[model samples]
Target chain A: MVSDLSVLLTDRQGQPYSLTSERIKHLEYLCESTRRDIVDTLYKIGRGHAGPSLSMVELLISLYFEELRFDPSDPKWPDRDRFILSKGHGSLGYYAVLAQRGLIEKRELDTFESLGSRLQGHVDSNWLPWVELTTGSLGQGLSYAVGVAIAAKRQAKDLRAYCLLGDGECQEGNVWEAAMSAAKYRLDNLLAIVDWNNLQGGVTLEVMPSLEPFALKWQAFGWHTIEINGHDLQAVLQAYHQARQTKEKPTVIIARNIKGKGVSYMENKVEWHGGTVTKELHQIALEEINARLSELSQYADEKYGRNHG
Target chain B: MANWKKAPIREALGKTLVELGDRYPQVLVVNADLRNSVKSIYFMEKYPDRTIEVGIAEQNMIGVAAGLASLGFIPFAVTFARFASKRAADQISMSVDYCRNNVKIIGAYAGIFTGAQGVSQQMIDDTAAMRAMPNMTVIDTADVHEVRSALLFAAEFSGPVYIRIGRDEWPVVFDETYTFELGKGRWLREGSDVVLLNSGILLPYAVEAAELLESEGISAGVVNMPSIKPIDAALINDISRNVGAIVTLEAHNVQGGFGSAVAEVTAANYPVPIEMIGLRNEYSESAPNDALLEKHHLNPPWIAAAAKRALDRKNRLRC
Candidate 1:
């Protein structure tokens, strides 16, 4: 159930664009559609990371549709802004966003995790040109992002590098090593967003109770830290804008997210972190997403006229 | 013998990196707090802007190097072989090798070269670990000239490469006129009875062993196999068929080092009796370089004895 609703498009030059209430509704609708796609894709594969992928839908939609600057037709453009999915197990959401952006054929989404499919179980750049780096094992993405940002600084390019990490992935020592180096290089061109879903593999807090002081740890690493409700479209958008304004240091936005935002049964459930989605569960999840999509469309039509729909 | 000048591979690496800095404008050197020890300091001195010092963090250094490579910058990530191959192996596998990033991993103090630092710092199994990774090109520098050439080659080559270098001084195996090529072994001395195949800092010892064998009427051949992966299979096949026996020496463990690489090639192509001379599936203690080499039976006399043993095995099979 794709919608023909058009939102304001930002220019390739990364010029400022106004986000109206109608556009926010459209973004939310898009996020809902992405959730449906994630469920359907995982249900077909019979095995995929459901919780992490579902939680990352809004963040991915915001970046691809609203924040990132690039021509979908030419994904390998040198001057294009880069996005690295550090928590690559959430690639179902990433693939859905890529399909929605028209970067990949929408039909190809069905081939995900299948033999020889470009959309591998984990993110692999070799299989897909849109992916900047191959990542599956956690905590390495920030370092790669730092290198890209350093390159942007050296070449005096105005491009910025963004990485989306998971809260659980932060337990990796390499993430901090990357954080220290990102600050040491004064990588103002770099921005990172951590999906603080609070549940990692098996209840993260139970596994490592010490992860509580997460935001302070990033601040101590010399990053410009911002905390926000990740699902709130407006707050997530504002965090992106604020990060761009920050200078002479890297910025990290700790987006407080639910493990599974939209679906009822999967929310905050670690078992859904990685599992095979059955047909009944898939239908239920799709119905939940579809219901939200319809509500968003009705709100957009009533508030901003039928043309907005 | 007295006139032959010895140069530390680390110094040669630094000098070659500076030369590479001049040649490839996009070349970036990444260090994991071992700049001076790994010889990355030379590149840091010349191209300060191009050098990234990630203090004592090999995992992050490799990830950052992979990131730089993704952006079309050729990054040479330098650290001790022990740390780079062991501590940061997963990062190297995922970030550099799997991604096929053009990151040159210069693993300094490879094998038993970290003498005073003891077995913990020694990387006897790094060759095995690095070679095991798909899309990883493993190179062990034989001498000062080879280390220079290996750096130059790795700088120009576009892929993930692990260049292993020793910490202490080594006798020059190749002169200025010698040219280096990837995956091609060089023949130092040719004989028909037995072939002395070696790599890394042990190449000179192999040559000395060959000389000792010659005096003992053993007519041994010496070949230096620098490229562990994409190894000189043709030379190995030729030696296996014609020479009939082989003795492989390295300043590494025999399990997954140069010897195992040579044995794999010979076992698959031409089955020949082979004797491996190196650390025998065990760790070394803190000692001087000479004592460590002697203890591990990686010295010339021991290597010569191993060659004689292989020759005897070949003769027995013939009988």
Candidate 2:
């Protein structure tokens, strides 16, 4: 099973654009299934940040299924690309992707936030090997990614570091500090993705109105900035490829997306940012995600055949 | 009184870091834009490729250190104790301590040594704040020798460590033969009537106070406690049991510092009368180093007076 994954994930030419359409369709299906898992896990746990997690599904799917290099059996594989979830409250999406990638057992998703569970409320590296750092007290993950990138460059390792942050977490002063240093060091191997759903605890506008011209802020910090619709798989993939091609500077993708992207009642709803899902709502969410997954799988079968050739 | 050889604590720290950098290839230095002040510039000069400058971001410095640690690198992050403890406390707690990263956090200009820099620069609450953190080994070095030994110890020891060093020149208390052991207090002088518990740049004052107590026909024992978190409870208990009275001195606030740590140990193990001589509850203004010490009642005479008061209280308990 691991060998099959390695064969599929190995980029012979080191270009993600060389991936087949079948692989992209398979990744799209995996993303839908991951969304279902996230909703189900949060509903079972009785508490979680559903809105933020839902918003980051496609971005994580792109990284885990298409961009990142790793052996699910050997998570500590040296030279493998690294990812740090700076906005760690969105761990539901992260854990779902990890499970889907076989880095963690799928059944473990049921134990999230439970007693003695590795899946804590926040990302804890001590509890899991795949988690690179303990985060949740926002704005620290990007700096950590910068450190990893620096180490990779010093060692001349063929590796890259990616960090995912929330749009709300940009308010933290440490983020800009890391941004400045990464650019100053010309860490071209580092990438930062901001989930620009634009709503924080309340609306980001209501909480703090200063984040406008966000991409320009990254540009001002000397980063190569890319703006894309986060929910669009093709745009996310293209942005990542562009980031890889850029040299002598760090890159940040301001992925504009909706808070609760796939669910009908939860979409764009502030209440779902960190609220418990009722049994009825959970059922509705699962039905919607399952429908999407079925549509994606059928499309892949019809377009690329059952073997995804 | 003979004058002792003195040197700035930062120079000793820089020298030791360079030595460690040579000995351990994985040893790295992370500075938060205070390279000149923290003396990490020396390390940067020696190993240009090994030094990481995070600019004025203490929080980012700590997080980066943790990241390096996760990759099995020994990253010593340097910044003012004031900022390292207060400004980046959350990162230290969550990113480093919680994750059990082998990151050495070197907090320079701890206590009242940042004298003219005023209360904002001074770190009176660092020991307390770092001690309260789980999986954090807190060490406050006394002299240049101890500073060198402490940095060496931090380089070898795994897990999170917060080492506090002062900026001003301090009297050399230990010789070249001095060895540093984590979680063990060093006994400098021996007496029976009272115990002078001290740490950091204030050790010279405690030694002076013990001598003063001797001239006054009082027997005072002096012990230097470098490790503040896993404090030498056995030594503190023995001193409390044998001496029956104690006087705790530090350049930090009396609350949640060396004094508070000793008091807690004695209160739980051996309930002996202890007098804590430190910043009672006020911030130090921008004054000279000596003036700051004098204003905070941290001079030798004040330490001797506090020892006498503890002895008097011990005598009163008999009545």
Model 1: lDDT equals 0.86
The reply for model 1, stretches above 4 Å from the true place, is A1-14, A298-309, B1-3
- Clash pairs detected, candidate 1: none
Model 1, range A1-309, lDDT digits (tens) per residue? 334333333333546555567667877877887788888888887888889988888888888876787776798999899999999998888999888766888789889988999999999988999999888899999999998999888888889999999988988999999999999999988999999998888665567757768889989999999999999987888888888878889999999999988999999997888887778888899889888888886543333321211
What are the per-residue Cα lDDT tens digits for candidate 2 across B1-319?
A: 4377898788888888899999999999999888888888889999999999888888889888887776678999988898877789998998888878899998898988774977788888889899999899999888989899989998889889999999887798898878889889978889899999987778899999999999999999999999888899999999988889999988888999989999999999989889998889778888888887788899899999999999999889868
| Candidate 2: stretches off by over 4 Å | A1-20, A204-207, A299-309
Model 2 chain B poorest ten-residue lDDT run: B1-10
iRMS values in order, in angstroms? 0.8, 1.1
lDDT of 1 by residue, B1-319 (tens): 1234688778888888999999999999988887888778888989999998899999999999988887789999888898888799999988889888899998888888674888777888899999999899999888888888888888888899998999887788788766678899988888999999888888878888888888889899988888888899999999999989999887788998889999999889999999999889999888988888788888888988899889999999999
lDDT of 1 at A169: 90
Q: Give one digit per residue, the lDDT tens place, for model 2 in A1-309.
A: 111212222231363334455555766787788888888988888888889998999999888766787767788898788899999899878999899876888999999888889998888888888988878889999989988898888888878999999998999999998998999899999999999987888565456858878888999999999999999876787788888889999999999999988988888888888878899999999999888887777544433312212
Q: Count the backbone clashes (under 3 Å) in each candidate.
A: 0, 0
Alpha carbon lDDT of each predicted model: 0.86, 0.86
